[model samples]
Target chain A: MPKKNLNKLREKIPLLEDIGKDGRVWSDLCKQYGVENPDPPWRITLESTCEVLNEGACALPVLERRDEEDKLSEEIYKDVPYPERQLLALAHSMIKKGFFREEELGVQMEKVYKRLSAGT
Target chain B: MSKSDKHDHNAAPMVDEISDFEVLEVAVRELCIEKGLFTQEDHNEWTEYMHTLGPLPAGRLVAKAWLDPEYKQLCIDDPVKASLEVGIDWINSMPSKFGTPSDYCNPRILVDTPTLKHVVVCTLCSCYPRPILGQSPEWYRTPNYRRRMVRWPRQVLSEFGLQLPEDVEIRVADSNQKTRYVVMPIRPDGTEGWTEDQLTEIVTRDCLIGVALPRADRKADDKRPIHKAVHPYGH
Candidate 1:
């Protein structure tokens, strides 16, 4: 199947000017409903990506910094639900636990490619 | 060549090559199994669990709520608990005892009233209540839908053939975090004594997503063109 160019698709959609980098639109809506807004999804993705990459480079432990981060802002992330974030977090945890070396991923991926090509 | 044969020449290429994403997915799954994160049986069980999911359970939940007032309050107050009535245990239903790691446990049922309407969109990603509502529609996952639905909801809704009165308030619920949402539309008129089964038939997936409304005569969503997968699942 052909992959979609999401960046191109996003350009066609009309967005509101009030949708700030902090996700004010979501925050305002949550405020109207009397519920606390979770930190912007983009921010969560950004942080997760950074954490995962850092973990991959130098086997660091999972940062239990959610509590500190939550207290820093009124609109803070309460939970991580994004699939990419979940996948990255899992990889990060596994790396930290010494399950496998980050460098070995390329070799494993090649084996997987061979298996797929062989229709196994 | 014939016109048909000429048309086939312009069609998308059906390549047998595995993509990098496919290779990576297999590599990760295999590595996870090797590391004791999960077994092959667990992965197979999860696939089987996914096959059992559809819009029927979510529709039944709405139907039951519409038939019973207390149930409607339960739906609004504690949606995860209310999901139990439809046999969807968000936490323990999947392979993971806690919940599906990506979807998490929180589910909010947005109950619509005469003066208020609710529509859901995940501006960052498509965070759907898959346990009950099944796979999200392709349109829902599109960047166009994600960006436009949150900002120009009325315009987008109208494009989906749903138009509300000027006085009615439209709330666009952005499912950006753990809280997944399912819109429970108000029971339509002319179905005062309808059975739960009958009501459930009308509450289609589109209604649950708040793109359309249930009608006594309409038991299905408006027909739209489907993008056929090159390799459909379970083939």
Candidate 2:
């Protein structure tokens, strides 16, 4: 059973635009989490020199942020769920949490940057 | 060489015409139609539904979660409930009111951390989250990928251009049973002041499929080998 507020928001959000790439909050998510590594470097090799492969989009940024986040977590992660479930989990979380308020999503990012700068 | 070639040509070789499997598939389809188990229209409708699906809705789901904490919690707790926000009534959205025959309603959301990156592949069949994410990709339905990815995820992720540190955990969610899974990667840093629309653009099909993650500039999945069909079905 869902909570009343979450149920209400579910009725309002449109399907297509929900995941649009907004720049503000995402940077904060990165800093708040304190992720240090960005993605594995993309180096072309003999096996992949001419292969026209289609790994879905969003591969690069996700890889990039993953490193930074690892620095914050302090826990060993040998069993992360697969992509499908992970996407599903976040979507589920949104329904209950009501997204980062535009301001919070934006304002919080600065905190992340400041935290990193203090140490570096 | 000439004597051996002559002998090889004379031999009554194994059957080489239409494959037995192909014949059986045709037989079953025709028989189903003949028996009225379902009209040809029903199968065609299902195909049309398949053609209409993609990673769009699933991407939106992720973006919305990033913007709203409440919604994200809903997603993490009960994916079936969270899906309603995207207008996908898993139980009643498709031709089958009870959800697809293969992908059931039990969808579990997996959250990603800096030390954890996730990707999904079915080893037995192409079991996917059809209601929100649409149809599974062609490569995902192949036996070679399924057989290899679960047991050798790091090796496979490397092939997909994802190479994590040894300390990072690589959990592979196998949809071998009833529950289907999707990844919910934490938002990345490139965009500092993006709108909902801006965020959704980065969550591509491949990201939802677990091969990649969402970013600010990217609007598409990685380009891969495309094997054209002799007679491709267009919806």
Candidate 3:
């Protein structure tokens, strides 16, 4: 993408700031994709964030993604698409802004992923 | 001594054995304390804080807005700041300065105009704005409610004894995301000269959730069937 176009797209998604920030990403997503929040916007955002990263790659920031072994999950990192990982990282940054606690993110993300997959 | 007395004594232990949740709750609390993750005082203080919360503060916020146009606009423009006027600091009031883990911080007040109405539902889970409005009702947390409210809002509202005109726009605010919501219903016709206290009394939890409208005479939520517990906690 052109630098200007990328900047414009970034500017449009103000929810990039935190989990609880304004729903700029939400309204923009709604307008661009006709995706109405069939549930609370945050739940959908959390679910989507997990979905986009599921068994693909760690999209979180370098420091944030560090495991006890100082290595990425070999199973998750296998064959992860570059663009997909980039998107996941972007979503992680947004969540880290306020919605996430460093210690609980893994557990919360797993629960959210399970709940979304359950389709309830 | 008697046959019936023997049966009653046997039933008591069965009821005592019913709580798997209590076992998990004890395990978590003990583990957290043992690990020094949080002190007993911290848990007790949060319990105290939970006791302090109810729908009153949120109701008062709506009442204050109804009585003042500028405050009402502030409510729409900056809900977190406006929440302070009603004595709720979303971030600071609780033990966590960052706000509740699940509820987050931002609150969206869906302003009801003459033609439009709003209702809330969490299709995934029972995600409510508990900071100001206290815990959600039992029915609000039901999977049945979560499934039906989004698809058939009018029917659900009707079940709650709230029927609107066909011309009225009923917007369902699905609380699937982080941003919590409360519906600021349009001020009713008869409450013109009522004091803030009176106005506050009428804005029950249901009204804020947009299942019911505020009225001059009504001061409490509609009673519903509450599933009784074997050993319910004493308040």
For lDDT, the strongest prediction is 1
Give each model's whole-structure lDDT. Answer: 0.63, 0.53, 0.60
Give the winner by TM-score.
Answer: 1
- How does the DockQ of candidate 3 come out? 0.02
Q: By summed lDDT, which 10 consecutive residues of candidate 1 chain B come out lowest? A: B226-235
**Which ranges of candidate 3 are over 4 A from the true structure?**
A1-120, B1-28, B35-38, B226-235
Model 1, range B133-178, lDDT digits (tens) per residue?
9867656755557768887899888889888999999999998778
* Candidate 2 stretches greater than 4 Å from native: A1-120, B1-32, B44-48, B226-235
Give the candidate order by descending lDDT: 1, 3, 2
Considering lDDT, which of the candidate structures 1 and 2 is the better prediction for this target?
Answer: 1
Query: Model 3: per-residue lDDT, tens digit, B190-223?
Result: 9979898889999999999999999888998987
Ranking by DockQ: 1, 3, 2
User: What TM-scores does chain A show, candidate by candidate in order?
Assistant: 0.31, 0.25, 0.26
TM-score against truth, every candidate:
0.57, 0.54, 0.57
* Candidate 1 positional error at A10, Å: 17
Model 2, residue B69: displacement in angstroms?
A: 0.8
Per-residue C-alpha lDDT of model 3 across residues A1-120, encoded as one tens digit per residue: 355533332332222223223213323334554445422223322222322222123333222332200111112221222222223333334333433333444344445445443532
- How far is B183's C-alpha from truth in model 1 (Å)? 0.7
